[model samples]
Target: MRFKLSTVVLPSVLLLGSACIVEAPGGTSPEQRRAATVTQIPPLSVRNGANLGRKVELVAATVQPGRLTPGERATVTVYFKVLEALEEDYLIFVHVEDVGGRMERMNVDHKPAGGLLPTSQWKPGETVKDEFSIYIPSNESPKALNIWLGLWDPRTDSRLALTNPDQVRNDGRNRILLAQVPVAQ
Candidate 1:
């Protein structure tokens, strides 16, 4: 019996071609691969006032390796300033998101700017240095990580001009600052 080339070799060639495609280890599908890639990045770190807006300005950011256990965690430090002095109350948001869609919020103090700068009312000439330490999980699959910082203006009872269009607008709203940091292992 003679074997036809089309019938015998075609299927073998196709099977070998498909096998050459690399797949992620441990049953990670294509979608999971893409998601993993997105999560490997570290959080953003701003270094200058130019990256900030009128309301909340980014002074600087720093990070250090905290623990190297099952899940990697890094202590992130950030500095910011609030322009203009207002009697209204405000809240700052700092957070980190991992590749697996896990997010963690950083603890920050918005009162008595002692560790920061300019404890009194936010003045034009005065500068504030607010710091926050954030932890990033090690199970993040070594992908891109996202970090965000926002300023919420709770001055509903008072009428004060809020700076930073991205954080707050003239319509009496709030705004936030965004930063992207790349991570590698």
Candidate 2:
């Protein structure tokens, strides 16, 4: 049976003290990114963590109606494109953590559209869109939650490579912290 989309509530955020991230002196140039190996990603199986996600880039990740209440549902939309052809299907991973680094969160792991659309169907250089609803747990009190997004292959339980290693958490799990979701009491 295929793995269903489910929320695994972990006790607390993994607080690895913030590390400084350095960007290009001026800005990202196509020539620079291509040189970094981000513009061309290889298949997941033969991939290396050091390569990061230079090939398939996550363009925009937004939480509609950004604020959430206990037990409420919110829509999350993501826009991304593959700079090169991808040969394997990948999963979307979402993790909601408190801004204070305290309290628990719901981490979601599943395929697109509840196991319908797979990343393998993505065409090179074509932008792909994905949307889904996330239900905030009623058990916890209201707080600001950071919504982190990333891609992983369920078959091997491995996270896709990322480009920036300093600004985000590089747990070797390939997660990218995308946005902040305010939980109102």
Candidate 3:
């Protein structure tokens, strides 16, 4: 029996074509790229991204690709200026909450300046640049998200009170307003 080229080779060719492997654009997979990009700052150190008190002042919060979606991560950069000299080192905390100040997620890290640089070492007029990436959970995802920043002590499990009561949210722990992230498709 003669084998027809179309019948015998077509399917095999198509299968091989489909199975062909394509290297990730730069030879790194999605996860690899994500790892390389990393959250600009480590999660262990966190400080108020805003000026919530005399100790430190939050100068700005910038989110890249402002549009957030479920399961996607975005980079957030928080800028701070030292106000008054700090006596001791402190931990920084970031809260991602719903519209009403109800927290959906929170990140408590060392100072945005990094572990080596603590709040105590920070100098007045100095700038603190902190950045991180957060992956939005599908179940907890909302149309809009709010970010707040503050300081905390892990040993006492207490959050540093903000000098400005006006900036405090529902709990009044003094989570300075970072920004409102609007979710887009």
Candidate 4:
């Protein structure tokens, strides 16, 4: 008895090569295709209320074109209520997550140009509106999106104080609001 390298190698290679060819999953069933393609956006989990100090309370949030074009930009509006005058500097952080796991942050101020404000300066029972526009890159995939809103205390210079070593953990606590927007072709 004798064994040839070519004979064994050739057959094994052919078998493996053929096995690699996979037929596209059946697309005839619309529901099946949708189920396979759809991805659920993660929930925005928050522990503490928006009012960190004593006044500013995030009331509601709304986004225009809740559904966005693949490469288009959209605006998000956040409304807040001031229970008492905000004297110390504070910041509103808006976080956005795309299907590709890319995240971006936008900051808004209590006053249009005054920059981040202190909790004490925000008068009691005052309604404030903050808006931001985010541009979705043309190359992003069409999938579910996640958005989160947070509040932070800024330094005396009205700069966001993000030096906390445990700042990452704050995601769970600072997230006052969450939303999912869709992107389509």
Candidate 5:
């Protein structure tokens, strides 16, 4: 039994190509994400809270180094409480924007807990603490920066509604205003 070169090589090539095409959630390749560490802790009082639809509440959001400067690193930690179980897994979009909120500098968009525990997996009454870091580019002007976050279904391109519109400030795109860090001039 002799195997033709075309048959052997074609199958091998096809397998190799397919293996390289794996897609992570939101159509991003795996190499695009930074490692994330998320922890679960007992429920606490919400220092700053906003309701995302009726299923989840953004309990609190805090930024370290309270201020920022060009080429500096800042860490953002957010807390959430599941108000109700969700059926669809949603991605969290964390946006760093200019002071005026007219332009976006960068976005740290990823699945909850780095995809280890998605929104669909969250249970009612559970408190989730997620932390991630971002670098302030040196090219940005010495102006305050705003950090915004929200949940969205990447497939449908729709964001979860921010129920407390009166209490929370949004970008008109449903993104909650998480924090504002003053940049050293």
Candidate 6:
């Protein structure tokens, strides 16, 4: 079978081009990107919404299994919807702590999408779904676990403020408590 040169070369070029991360032509700012009309914002799968800094909203968070046990793993998924433009990328932190937030049991912190997608690149109304896994330490006490998360600037270690401070439980440190799960005895 003979393949046309144009067909073979075109596919190769398209694949190579798609791999590149390019800024918007003309250096469009996040505001400009948001100004451009998008048909619709994608619907969120989870409904636990919390506003953060009036820029980003935590659309929802989920912990698999709903209960925790020492020496086991649980998947934590967080959904963030961009409400306004952001000029800098922020790191996401997921912390598993004792019921009273007195002790941290585990911390799963990383850049969104493993550093592939940054907050600065997010457009208004765009939702980002990030997932990470947490392993409970075997030595941890059999108590309830409070799952908390927030976006923070790594350089300054400043966290985004929780806009709806009264809606959910928040530690003075800017950590928004997402859920509480009982540790199986």
Instruction: Name the best candidate (by TM-score).
Output: 5
Per-residue CA lDDT of model 5 for 1-185, tens digit only, reads 11111111000000000001222455323333222223443243225567998888887665555556677676666778888998887888777777675445677776675454667767787776666676666666546666678998999998999887666666666787665556766
Which candidate, 1 or 3, would have the higher lDDT against the true structure? Answer: 3
Question: lDDT (0-100) at residue 97 of candidate 5?
Answer: 74
Q: What is the C-alpha RMSD of each candidate to the true structure, in Å?
A: 22.0, 14.0, 20.4, 22.6, 18.1, 16.5
- Count of clashes, each model: 22, 6, 13, 14, 0, 0
2 against 4, candidate with superior lDDT: 2
Cα TM-score per model: 0.45, 0.63, 0.62, 0.54, 0.72, 0.71
Per-residue CA lDDT of model 4 for 14-78, tens digit only, reads 00000011123321244423322212221321221245444455555555654666566665555
lDDT of model 2 at position 26: 45
Give the local distance difference test score of model 1: 0.36
Model 1: per-residue Cα lDDT over 55-100, one tens digit each: 4455555555422222444444445444545444444444444434
Residue-level lDDT tens digits of model 2 in 36-89: 222333221111122235667676544545457676566665556667766677
> Which is superior by lDDT, 2 or 3?
2
lDDT of 6 at 118: 71
lDDT of 6 by residue, 59-159 (tens): 76555645666777766656777899888778887676675655545666677754546777777877676666766666765456666779999888799
What would the C-alpha RMSD of candidate 3 be, to one decimal place? 20.4
TM-score of 5: 0.72
Arrange candidates, best TM-score first: 5, 6, 2, 3, 4, 1
lDDT tens digits by residue: candidate 3, 24-73? 23233444333323233434333333455577766555555546766666
The lDDT values for all models are 0.36, 0.53, 0.51, 0.42, 0.61, 0.61
State how far residue 44 of model 4 sits from its true place (Å). Answer: 21
Candidate 3: stretches off by over 4 Å: 1-50, 100-104, 138-140, 167-171
Give the local distance difference test score of model 5: 0.61
> How does model 2 score by TM-score?
0.63
